[model samples]
Target: MIHTTPHYHRIACLCTEAVETLYLLGAEELVAGISGFTVYPPEARQQKPKISGFSSGKLEKILAVEPDLVVGYSSLQSDILKEVAEAGVDILHFNHHSVDGVLRMVRVLGSLTGRRHAAELLCEQLEGQISAARLESAARDAAGLPRPLVYFEEWHDPIISGIGWVGELIALAGGRDAFAELAGHARAKQRIVADPQTVIDRQPDLMVGSWCGKRFRPETVLERDGWQDVPAVRNAERGHIIEIKSADILAPGPTLITRGLPQLQALIRQWHEDRAG
Candidate 1:
């Protein structure tokens, strides 16, 4: 008898982005629990037990699920992993950056869950989508249009530009990032644009703010005296208020290209039309 190894029965996803990726990778059946912050797929919240959130959560609830494997990401989840592993639960941790990293993660997750073929297929699709966006950007450039200067706000408290994959995605979207120097650094400390006048000096043509999980208030931006000098504000251009959930962009997964890149393309196209007029 050729014994095919049995697939893992119950899996817990502590990271919201991984939950979405796993669902797309044909491992939905194995998902026994998911993070409370998972909002992309409504089904996850509806069906899976709320075991984890952005930071800390009910470890006992995660333990109660009795997951054969628990997935985690970033340093934020390190403590949770230590507890879970000490308790004798299996875990598959992933932390990656750049577009290539995301593909690797999909493949790894697929292998761990016995869905290698599904992972390969998904990776191919994601790469193709990214290629399409790049081609679109090139086409826009060929038409003798200039790219807009972009400032992407990941946080507002100390004023930080995006870090890691988000910064990379901004470049791929055909816009020049005002804070590209801050890419690949830790999220909190990176791109501390402490001087509001520095933003005024840069004179960004477009300002895209995700503001993490909260709604990006354009009026708050407009209200600032230093910001009034920038073109995006004076024209009331309504600088694109992007609501990209942080988990997806920061995950270093296929969704960065799948979800993040396309949104960037759309914004670039909008900029092109605005500039032409």
Candidate 2:
């Protein structure tokens, strides 16, 4: 796969994910179109023609681009891919649920874009950053720094806990996830917090909410019935309730490694230090 040459000249990205990663791999020249939701690097917006939204794309617009390679994420776009395929367009769909899966996606994109060398280098850099964070946690652990209990809310309504790589990110950031068991589930619904009181029961030391791009209002979290007793809510002086941008953490691409992981690491470190003081 590393040695194979890329046949695609005109490429279309069906989501923000592929668009960001592809640009990172230095494949910007190959892109003919990208999803409207892609905002990272800023230049992608100014350069590539927008062809898709979150789940679907403009078929006629895509056809106009005459892309030989079309890439996206999830089964949600299966129908779109089917129609695109029927129109003789090549499709590459990726669904990465874990950190390793995210790295694999990078390698796959590199191979697809004929930039294996660059991809390997990027992977090494990400691994090094994660290792540095883990090492810091290890040193702190040796010094009796306890891992903070973290609860990550992926959604606000009906409450969804962090999914897949999120739990892993929290751990790497030196926090124990309150709903670590649910991290294995790929779907958000599978990770749903059935009872709001479950969070109270878990007693997370830190509460981080992304709410998938919608503004994260701490008031909503604070307003939950009987939530006043929860340690995360009870603590006000130490930055108990935090918000991470959805674009930074939710996107399964280079941004997650570059932006998401660092934010998580900082918060976990801060949470620990706050209690230590």
Candidate 3:
């Protein structure tokens, strides 16, 4: 008989992705606490004690939970994790910036929690989703469908480009990332577009805004100066400006493949049909 018991009995997840992954792995019962920002498994938000936010956490509250282990993500949580470590609690921090990295995270987390088999099955499911998306994109390409150049905005104020995983998923979903070169940068600051005019210069066929959990206003893109001539802006009236919720795309988890990628593929497919029409 295969052992499905998790090693960690009480885990505190300081990120939404970890919380979502735990739920997907059927390890939610092991989670003692979760980040206040966790919303994917709505039940998590309701049931789990909120222990931390992205960059801030009350160490005392975290300690109060008496977690056997703490899981967090990104350098943004380094300081918080460090504090937790100083308190003599074991912690694991993951900094995955691409699709492959995200997958690796799932596998590692599963192994650490003693749910290796479950994790492998989950990865296979996710990989299958990705393969299906790639095949769909290839079919479209073979049918002479033009892949739209997509400008994905992660932030509106500084005009940040999508991260590595987002760019890779865009390609899998039948669109070319307009800022693919910038997506490789690990830091969000490094992905910042220096000038708004650069976007106009790229002339992307579609503009997608996630805004890192903030509401994406398509009107904001349409109102940019000298953007009237840009293809994406000109086509704004025809649904070229899209908004994907950050929870679906920004979180480095299964949702990227399950929810985010499908949305991108559908949008790109619509773009192709609209252009062909």
The alpha-carbon deviation from the true structure for residue 114 of candidate 3, after best TM-score superposition, in angstroms, is 2.0
Judge candidate 2 against the unseen true structure and give its global Cα lDDT, from 0 to 1. 0.84
lDDT of 1 at 268: 73
Leading candidate by lDDT: 3
Candidate that beats the other on TM-score, 2 or 3, i.e. the better one: 3
Judging by TM-score, tell me the better candidate of 1 and 2.
Answer: 2
- Residue-by-residue lDDT tens digits, candidate 1, 1-277: 2212436779899987677878887678788998887865679889888898867866798998889888898787888998899989987777775677778888887877777888888988988887877777788689867877878887888898877777667767888887888766765675788888888899987777777777777778888878888876775654353456554565456666877777777777777776666
RMSD of 3: 1.2
- Candidate lDDT (C-alpha), each: 0.77, 0.84, 0.90
The backbone clash count of each candidate, in order, is 0, 0, 0
Q: How do all models score by TM-score?
A: 0.91, 0.95, 0.97
When sorted by TM-score, best at the front, the candidate numbers are 3, 2, 1
Residue ranges of candidate 3 with Cα displaced over 4 Å: none
Model 3, position 129, has a per-residue lDDT of 94
Candidate 1 positional error at 266, Å: 1.4
Off by over 4 Å in 2: 1-5
Error of 1 at 207 (Å): 1.1
